[model samples]
Target: MQARAAQDLKARMTDALVEAGLTYAGAVAHHTPRRLVLSVQGLLDQSPTLREERKGPRVDAPEKAVEGFLRGAGIDRSQLQERDDKKGRVYFAVIEHPGRPAAEIIAETLENVVRNFPWPKSMRWGAGSLKWVRPLHSILCILTADSGEAQVVPLDIDGIKAGDTTYGHRFMAPDGFAVTSYDDYTAKMRRARVMLDADERAGHIWQEAQNIAFSQGLEVVEDKGLLAEVAGLVEWPVTLMGEIDEEFLDLPPEVLQTSMKEHQKFFSVRNVQNGDSAGGIVRFITVANIETPDHGATILAGNQKVLSARLADAKFFWENDLRIVRDKGLTGMAEGLSDVTFHRKLGSQADRVARITALAREIAPMVGAKPDLAAEAAQICKADLQSEMVGEFPELQGVMGRYYAQAAGHDDGVPEACEMHYKPLGPGDTVPTEPVSVAVALADKIDTLTGFWAIDEKPTGSKDPYALRRAALGVIRLVLANGLRVELASTLVRPYHQNIRAALERHGAIPAEELNLPELSFDKVGLVERYQESKEGGTEDVPAVDDLLAFFHDRLKVHLRDEGIRHDVIDACLAMDGNDDLTLLVKRAEALAEFLKTDDGENLLQGFKRANNILTQAEEKDGVEYSFGADVKFAEVEEERALFDALKAADGAIKPAMEAEDFAAAMAAMAALRPAVDAFFEAVQVNAENPVVRRNRLNLLGQIRGICLAVADLTRVEG
Candidate 1:
């Protein structure tokens, strides 16, 4: 995160400074909580004076256009000269800009950067029109030459003026002092209890936290994000360790940790003797701004006092929730979900839960989970969303459900399923391996994809408000990691039909107009009510199950794009059958991707494209397809006859290879045809004088297309 932010700051400040007329070799931007500092090196005393040629509109063009150009360039009719151009004679002007001192340029640039800083949010302070993210503070601008002589760059903004003096460590060393140069300023700040660099502060905070936890035989729960945030809050870092009361320790470790980190910006200390995070968290650590004579004891005590109150509330919620879970059961906790809308048209969370439960039950056997166990996991997986513990901490929604499920005396794996179903929240997140977890996880993601697809709420470009891309990738990783052989299109149809019916009942019509798929028989969708009896089945051909299936291919394409398999390769395989079975599709894509990188594959692709091009033009010109009945008798050249023999051999080898899903073997078979195809293209001409012979050669080319496509759809693979 800091890396990207630093890069953006460097680029923005560089461009802004250059535009403001400061000349330098380069500039680097460093960020801390209190400041964004740009250290520019190899700076000239002043920007180089520029002599530029400016142009005006054509001489015969509109008067207003020429006048506007002149006015914008700050030139007059006397300064303009006539020049010859393609359209006509045009007016040109020479402009001279005298350079200003680097200090003056820098001061002006800094003022503008501060005044109109591109913060996502800013505020006006003390009635000034200029806005800033924070209140006005001192500006310390300086310019130094190679000889080591330094001058304080003059700047004055909103009544605050630049000076050689800057204060440090708001509490510990708040007094201001003067300095001569960058080196002097940093050394002074360090001595005054301020760590000038954010990284240094972060290192000190983390090392101290770890040491404090280690002395107590526990480890600091590593939250890089929380560490970075807390590091920004102080300059003189004082890491303080505090204890959680024994009563609150009975609450889930996640609860205790999350409460401390979220509310108080403290890091949790965990006793992970078994090398699992599930090992309970035992204590907490917070930071102080300064050191005291009595050390951090007073600070730790005050922090614990505040932390205990927060944990007391959490304990109350946990106990009350466990009581609700035991008395009312998971279903009782989930009762409020029916009223909570998941989407306006897709019904409530209760409706979504019911759909997920159905899908999970159907998917359980395929993923090696017991149907009953998968069904039970899916039913109550989201029950904690209604719990007070989850209400207070939404980030722990699935996690708290696991605790509640265990407390309710459900099966051991059921609780794990509740927590792990949301596994792999992102690219770096882990995919769950347990069967019940896999079943519920797949069901949950698949339902989201199909439901949104049914409503035509598919992601467009970068705007995936639903994070359907992550959902699809999650499904892909889960299936591939577990080696599940589920066909996605057939799997998604039941839920798609359910969504269509639900939407129809709610809004009285199927949203066929919004879907960009095959034909949808919206008027006849009523027939889906008697799904078993419906002759055509409840599925629509338009925006058919195939369309949503296409969406998964796109998501899968994004997921595998960085794995060296090109988009065209994924697209080629997506064009084939069983593309809905992502594992098979990806395997084919990977093999084909590897093949295309080889000499044999490259030659084969060219040969195939050449054959396809000839065949396509012939069929279009003749208004007839010359499909695969190429006869060796009509082949007038050895090359054509050799291709005929190769096609037969390839056709024989490719079929069984594809049947076994051995794409590497199939591609090898196809690759053997490349020599014959290249020789044929070189020797044989498809548009022969004899119409019969011409038809035979075109058909031979068609055979090449057919053979190549048999491995994977090579037509979609670009040259």
Candidate 2:
């Protein structure tokens, strides 16, 4: 809490100072359980005086406008100077403001920081209407000069006035001390048995804990987060390691760790040789505020007694859960999920599991998994949610399920899936490598995205309560990492359509007279048949598969942006056929992205743009498209004849490469026509004097546009 307080204070104070126009060279903030401190170095004494001229109405404007301008600028007519304006001569009012001392700004900024500090939650004390993380214990406000003179800034808020004195640790040194500078204050704090720096205190705890644990041939579990939190709980940290009770040692190591950490703010000390076994961790460590007379032996005993009681409760929960696992297996443990509501709009956890199971079964063969194994894994992965162990320790949800699955005589792949299906929870997390885990994992995330999108609950702006973006990223990693050739749109279209129907029926979005489910179309742009007349003659409810596909494309763009693929490049590929096949779309995008980096590709793009622009204008003006064969005989110039031959040759190469989905080869073939295109543009006048030649040249430009677009829509590829 103190660390968080320190961080909050630093950011808030910095913002306040900057807002108050008091820029500084450097600033640092520190906190302990009792207080927060901030020090600024080389802060400007005052904001610089601002001076500028305010423009007014034109010199020849009406008298009313001149009066309003004088009033707005706070100037008399005599003070206005004539200046040339866009329309006519305008009056300019000279404006000047003087700077104030930094001390004055600091006082006001500090008061605002104190009264309006965002403490997450705060409270009022005495009769004052002020709230803080705690009571505004004491305020240490000072300004030290290079001449060794220190002055206290006048600040009083909510009965707490500014002072030069602050007390150290409440128990060790309760006396207050006056300080002339930040350096003097910190030196006194260290001597008074208080460490003002949170990192310093945390480092002391961790280093001492390791040294002591090493003395006993055991190692403390490294938890930097827990260390930081524990450091915040005390002013002067005294690290102590305690032994666990022999009776409670038989409990699961995770149960032991969770019980100690959650209930007592303790760290587990593990015997490395016996790792993962029940008795692997035989000791626990705790940080105390003050050093005891017996060198922490008494503190160790008291903490161990409390830890034993906590572990006893954990052991009871563990054994009871183990009995259920052995007798009924993971399947029986998860039966309670039917009664648990996953969402009010969606169905129960059991309902989601069924959907995932069915989806996994369908997706298994595509990802190289046996359908039966993938189906079984999905059924049992979430079983731990119903276990008593997980009920007490929710962080161990997937972890405990793995243990129970193993106990239920399931194969390694099934148990592995039980724990690994939630892999790659974020971008930094690892994607599961096992084929069954991959299949089940993809199914789980895809079902989440599809189910929520069906209900139109997709994330907007920054709000993603369902973590749909992470799920989409997880799906991307699962596909790309494994090189799976799955069509994400086809995979999403069917189940997503079903889910849309279910969600629509559940939400009552459709007309009550009768349900009219539209046919799904995967061979084209949309997943659902759109623009259908309602039974009563309006619009009907159908899956928003196209919108959802676009959403996935947006996510995929974000995922690939770091790889140097531009959004316009992805948009160009998305505009083409087979965009539903994400693997194919990305493959084409990656190839096109690389190709566009070359001189040949760049020139070809310019040529294609030239052809497209002319064709678009000509078609709109003539009210007819020039998308047909170009006759070489009609070409009056050698450049036009050479382009015709280049077009035919490029057509032969791009056709087979595109047919085979070899985008690189097709892009290369298309690029080879750049010289022919450049030569034609340089030599031939496209709008020739003769009508036949003009018509033939327009058709040739049309062929250039058509052939290049066949590779990837170059119209969307930005210059």
Candidate 3:
């Protein structure tokens, strides 16, 4: 009975397998062994080891079917994967299934699983109920065995059944037939003149293009972006050389290059030996979409015609600009400046130029340039805004103005300054070493910074819309790189305060009279009073000029840190009053850093710290301040009297040394007192039995602190 039951099951399974299109071929001849071999090409009938049933309305989703088939196969979820949409069909993986063939089960599952499939965005078309990127198409499914025959997998999507064939490019290929293996499928596609791998085709195009350029003694400015884009646009790539019309060669090379790259996607080629020649012609490497019989002559001509029109427009703009320069003085070019907004809150370009001119006049003498020339340079710096060439290409801002100024017969320095003012625009950019250019450039940047600061638009964190941080760094590079002895605070503070006052007046935020302060010299006490009053009455939201000066000191530390200067050294130097002069501040910081590397300097700092700590502790504990002079008469011990004498000598030497800006000499003189300081601390007892002596000792420590701090804040030195 069991035998009969097994036979019945086997017959039913064999019938089902035959209906599913499985075939069996046995006793194939083995030529080498002279023997017959059994060949099987069909599903094995057995009780199902894994069973999963998915019930849904009629569906056609390949991905859904793939999921159910993998689940029913007891396959790991990690083994199943989905990839990007191909043409209009979604692709998915199906793992091994028991009882039924893997591909067959996947095909059957898809028909039932896709009825309730969801799509983020989908469309329905034609006379079918199925939805897809386009209408449903044929399914390609096959399961191959180690022997030879492919187990037929039946599937239908909108009445389209699974098959084992795929065609190549329609125009280049025509014949199509069944594919027994993936290798056979790829081989057939290749034989039909199709590149199955996109990267291989791209590599061929690049190598050929490079070879052609190298053979001609020219270089192809290979743009990877253009190459990738062109690769996508073509099934086959063929490189061709094209020539530019000589008439269009008069345009700037940058213009020619931009036109060719933007409009035609042509690679610009340069002659190998034309490095020093301005008249060298531009060779364009054209990438052709097809290998044409005429070698892409038609394509080249079409591209050249478009490029010629672009260059002609550039030439027209160039000529029109030269004519405008001849008709009007560069100053007269300000008529168009109204249209160019400098900043949303900072008025027009003309207005910015006016402010910069005012600043240049104030800053010129410090950089050793005549005020008149600096002011003139700043006035017309933005005048190129009126030029047609600059209007077309904004990058030619200062460059166009220089040409116009020279054409108008302005001073030689004026024209040069106009071009030089926007320099050091980036890290690799050259600084304006010329005195007039340096003065004007500093003025322009300072005006931008102060103007922005006045309007409360200072840079915070990484959000500098105005690029004030770059401007500030440019100012630092200009001053330090040129060895200019300009005071950043003196240059920035007055202009900054004035702009803030102006902005306040313009907005009716403050009374005009409230901002009016008497002009007093830096040495005058009235100057401090006037500046304090301005701080109190200036824009309520904006920080004071004093606060801005502090900000500059902070920026100076940041700037010097990269140059190997210590932050503590910068702090020590800046602690002195009137250290606002950046050049002097930097010199002092540098000198102090060099000095601190020495034994005397190191030991002196340690001594000074010890003295300071003791004095501070004494003052706090006694509830008494000791910021007074130490009388020589109160010195009882020999060491105390010796320290007093040393202090007098050192103070006299240091005063003259610092006045001469000989900070090293001043530090040297201070070092002379180290021994005396050590002796005094060793010999004398502070908080002694005698009140006057103890008070006197405390005052002596305070005096040493004061003298050392006068050179620099020694307390800032890290031991």
Candidate 4:
């Protein structure tokens, strides 16, 4: 009964709109939300008249065309008003316009009605000169019954008129019928087997896919982007399960998945037990636009045929790639590496791999990896570049190499390293956990960074074409997450110099004799000295290692800032020497930040600041500087003796705590000195009349400086 009433109301609304010279577009009724949204397109075609009493001519120079366009759109002339130009575009405004529609309907109307306006990038095809993102098609305009019973809103664009009816899916739903309201329209469309909203269709597909996977004790790899695109291409989704040809199963699973996704848009399914098998039994699920009467047999067959052809190409590449691998023994793969450019300025992949191997060897001990194994892993991490599977699917570079390396009977770590090296590619990605893999991954990232920096190819303003920023972040995560103690500068500088030297040698620009000289030779020394001078002068001319370290430090702050560490804490930790051990540096920073939250830490900082300020003033005022011999005999107050004893105890405790990597313990030990420090300040004056006593006080302040500097450069900390 409600449906019939809605239908009757929709017919009456359509009739009224036609009589009033209006048009209708599309409409939707949401059930869960219990709302009716009527999408009417073309109401903006109306125009209003201008009055001579308001100003001069109703439409002036430059806006006459727009006024004429509005007049042709059916807008009343009396309500036309001109407004100020804000966007520098000449446009007239409508004031006190009587034909008002819902906000949603008006927004839709503006989009659909302005078809023939001159857009910056537009096309005119077939017969008309209408311009749009694509060619103009039929406009969907509709009106709901809830607005009013007798009223009709005018909506017209070009010559298309609004109606209260719409069609569904092209094949499954070919017929259109009248609808008196949005509710009736949605119901009829649903009955006709159509999902009007793209998101609804996507949700249905994913839910069905998950159901299928769950029934078989498997999981669906839900790709939101793929789901959205597929949803747009269909109206009604019907998932069909199919199988690849048994022969094609010999191809790597990644290859199979990539081929199906790229060429056929099919989702690859994995066997419940065989997660890593390349040639294991694989099932593919496909989403079709219709539910055929044949239960999707014909669709499945058609898809299987298409997939067979794609798999054949993949098989050919796999077989052919093995032949190349056998002949090349990894070196054959390196042949095309030169052509596979790392970056236009960073040379080839082979060159990069070589540099990476060198760096990995150097960084191995720092991360507790066997140097030889680290070098070996780095050398072949990119060997998959020679594989046909990787060539077909670039995203599967590391994954494909693992399979090929295993096939070649290489060490298990070698293949695993290949897979792990490009890891932590994103925020949620895992860092290489194994010692060998971590070493190689760090090496690979560092080499890329140093190479790019050497060529002055650093990232600028959102333009990091080389992914240098990600690589830097990966390096930080790998070190900190794995608790490695690598010196970033030592590891980065050698590779940087090596790459620079290689470039010079390749062009025959530098003499062979000069190249053979030690790294610290005259030429290298001169370069280092020049860099140091620039740095001292506050210029951006530091060595690549120093600059890269600074960049890494910035990346570290970004990484740790989210963990709630104060910016000052990071600065203080980084200002200390031996900060290249990123894991240790972060540990120290985190401990110190937590300690600073305590009352003892707060008072210690205050006392330290006070002592530092007074000492600085005295040093500046007095010509003579104080030295470190505190005269025990001249100690006039017990507070001074207590402070001296506290300093000795803190020095003894903090040194070992830091050496043991117990930063929390070190901070606690430093915290203990606060009370003694406060007492000394309260009980004694540093600027005493006796020269010996003043010197002793100055030395005590210097002792505080030394102790604080032991843990971190407290001077760099902000109050």
Q: Which candidate's TM-score is highest?
A: 1
> Over the stretch 549-659, how does candidate 1's per-residue lDDT look in tens digits?
666677788788967679888889888888888889888988999899999999889888887888888888889988867789987988888988999999999999999
Measured on C-alpha atoms, candidate 3 has an lDDT of 0.69
Give each model a TM-score: 0.89, 0.84, 0.61, 0.75
Clashes of each: 4, 1, 1, 20
lDDT-superior candidate, 1 or 4: 1
How does model 4 score by TM-score? Answer: 0.75
Against the hidden true structure, what lDDT does model 4 obtain? 0.70
Best by lDDT: 2
Looking at model 2, the pairs that clash are 45-102
lDDT of 4 at 106: 43
567, model 3: CA deviation in Å? 2.6
Model 1 pairs whose backbones collide: 517-543, 518-542, 518-543, 519-542
In model 1, which runs have C-alpha deviations exceeding 4 angstroms? 1-10, 53-94, 273-278, 455-462, 498-544, 690-692
Query: Candidate 4 lDDT, tens digit per residue, 223-334?
Result: 6777766765666789877877889876777788788888888877777654643334378889998878998999999999998988898899888877777767665675
In candidate 2, what residue range of length 10 has the lowest lDDT sum?
526-535
Clashes of 3: 1
Q: Is candidate 1 or candidate 2 better by TM-score?
A: 1
The clash tally of candidate 2 reads: 1
C-alpha lDDT of residue 438 in model 2: 92
Q: If ranked by lDDT, best first, what sequence of candidates would result?
A: 2, 1, 4, 3
